[model samples]
Target: MRRLATALLGLTLALPLQAEWVFADFEAVSGTPQAKLFPHLESAGRGNLAAGGGQLALVWEDNRDGSPQVYAALRDLGRTGFSAPRRLSTGAEAYEPVVLGLGEGRFLAAFEQDGKVVMRVFSAAAQGPLATLDAAASAQPTLAAGKVGLHAVWGRRDGRFLRLVSAPLTVDGLKPHAGAARAVDTSPAQDEQLYASLVATAGGYALAWEDRRAGHTRLLTATSSDGRKWSEPQPLNEIPRSGTARELGLGRGPGVTRVCLAGDGADTVAAVWMDKRDFLSGYDIYAGVSTDGGAGFGANEKAQDVFGAEKPQWHPAVAVTPHGVVAAWDDPRDDSPDIWLAARAGGKDWSDDFTLDGARGTGSQDNPALLWHGGRLHLAWVHRDEQGGQVRYAQARWE
Candidate 1:
């Protein structure tokens, strides 16, 4: 009864005829093929892959040294392989690492350590920790670099609510600005907010998160002119009335989770998430776009064009390129999970779902991280099988 077939037909017609994604062979970023390499991929607010100034940076969690610790690898963008993995955390178990490329061979890595959100600045030559970003217990840290400075947001417990808090950082040393940390959400203490994604726009910044205030999980977004004050959170799943179609909205189903945000280096921002609205089936990847920064969002649309809802799609990541927006996720429709991608170019319908060319083989591919740099798409994901798990990286160019 759904219009899924028509949607797929439209998507097939939207793609560019001459352009295609050409991917290189996957290379191991973790470097240890036998050891268990669990690249931290749960932070949809940010990702484990970052690239800038002809360099690439990746961070993940692995147990190569007995206890779990955060590890990172760096390489020049023109190179095909990454440097040896470097352990960044010395004490306490670390998880959910998110990296940001700060240009000139430097990067910032943030992760959950000892119940707090901690960060470190590192390069090929030196590495050290910065002042802790949050004094209170926090998790799921995401970062964005703005014209003024760097912005960070994470979830922290405040009495009854698990709210989103933010802070500004100095660009030179990646240190938190003095007395700049504050709450970014206006919801009451009884409501819960988690898994926030952030991106810097030309005007200021935009954020998206999973909210449980309405007795059900919903996707909400907010905009800020500065990191101090934020606009009231608004729903992103509202479908306005059109010619022959009636108005509809989310909240009648299982709900939403794993929201990721990406910006087009101007005002446009996109939020992609795993939606469970198909109550009888499984989760699907959905996305909404905000043209005027994050002040308002259009009706939500499916990122994947799979007809049946039997298989589940999870762990979405998005990147905005000069052509348009591309979203990638782990899809199990083929019996084994593989990294799938779709794109919407020039405000057109989403392209038909396609798996990464080099990622189609044995083992399950999951937790994809995407970055568009130097006219190429940089991808990183975890591949696991009977032998062990490894963090793999690949690059694609549109030809």
Candidate 2:
């Protein structure tokens, strides 16, 4: 049966090539002047990396000027590294800055100034100053740029409670359209909503965040068509506990909540966060998927260390590429905080959790941010040290 054997070999040769993730060595984006770089925020909605138009853009909270301000840097496609860092915030206390790439060497950033929310637009040659978008004592501002100019959402304090506000941004003269800004969530003042994360889709945008409407922290999402009108917020997970929910397990301290969003600019959208549903003092990574343009999200799935979820995992970040979807977070499974990643392709199950920080014995790493562009995956995180914090970067390739 030599002909039969030959036919089997031919069939094997016709199969497609399988893709794998290949990560490069890590590098510090913030050099060693040692005054705390990109201070790690306990809240979500921070933008650490943005990849588009053959370039990578980074923004973070910097305090090198004696007062906290937003700073940015760019990595050109032809260069081996990033350009010199530059300050983007004019306010003395510009906190929680997030950046978005709008293609063609253009970028947009949003941050909290004093007690107001402001936005700034930048081009290749010049940039504009901060334009006041909303003045409602905001925090944890997030920005997403799509076919529209720019979309922003942040937590605004209304008397004794917090609410979510949205605004459509324009760079022409660095001004927001009057009356274009509105509240995304109009619930009672006691129903606090914070830490908003947004993803730009082909049709519009999808926003997700940690909501506290039911007296406990829960993941919620909403969809918007023009950045002004938004649908009602819906829970992404069913919290089992009636008390505090979706809290992080950092050592033995009180639990904290956070959420992040990622999308493929199409139908696929993902939200990842840390929750203590399995173990009150231990955290596990959870993911919610929305395939119908954020109309609704499926049930939450445990995405980290499916084999065993014994240790602590927090600050989960997600990114989608043509290859598939990947989620990374800081885990203490190896007795120390290290970055671990798991990926899934198509309809297959998630791959096993693999450590990306390799042999981490020195510093504590957290706040991992991920982006995929040009068939490459880019990651950024904070390396906490005795002196302060440093921004770290690494790249992954599909082989």
RMSD to native for every prediction?
5.3, 7.6
Question: For each candidate, what is the lDDT?
Answer: 0.77, 0.72
Give one digit per residue, the lDDT tens place, for model 1 in 1-399.
011112232242334555766677778888756645455566646478887767799998888887788889988888778999998886678778888878888888888888788888888878865557787887888888877568888888788777898888764554434346788875566688988888889888999888887776778888888777898888876422342111244343356788998987688898888876664466788888778987886878888886425778889999888777889888766667888888888664997776654454588889898888889888888888767788888887776
Q: Candidate 1's C-alpha lDDT? A: 0.77
What TM-scores do the predictions have? 0.89, 0.85
Candidate 1 clash pair list: none
lDDT of 2 by residue, 254-329 (tens): 2336888888888888888877766654788888777887878777777875433667787888898887788888
Error of 1 at 200 (Å): 0.7
Clashes of each: 0, 0
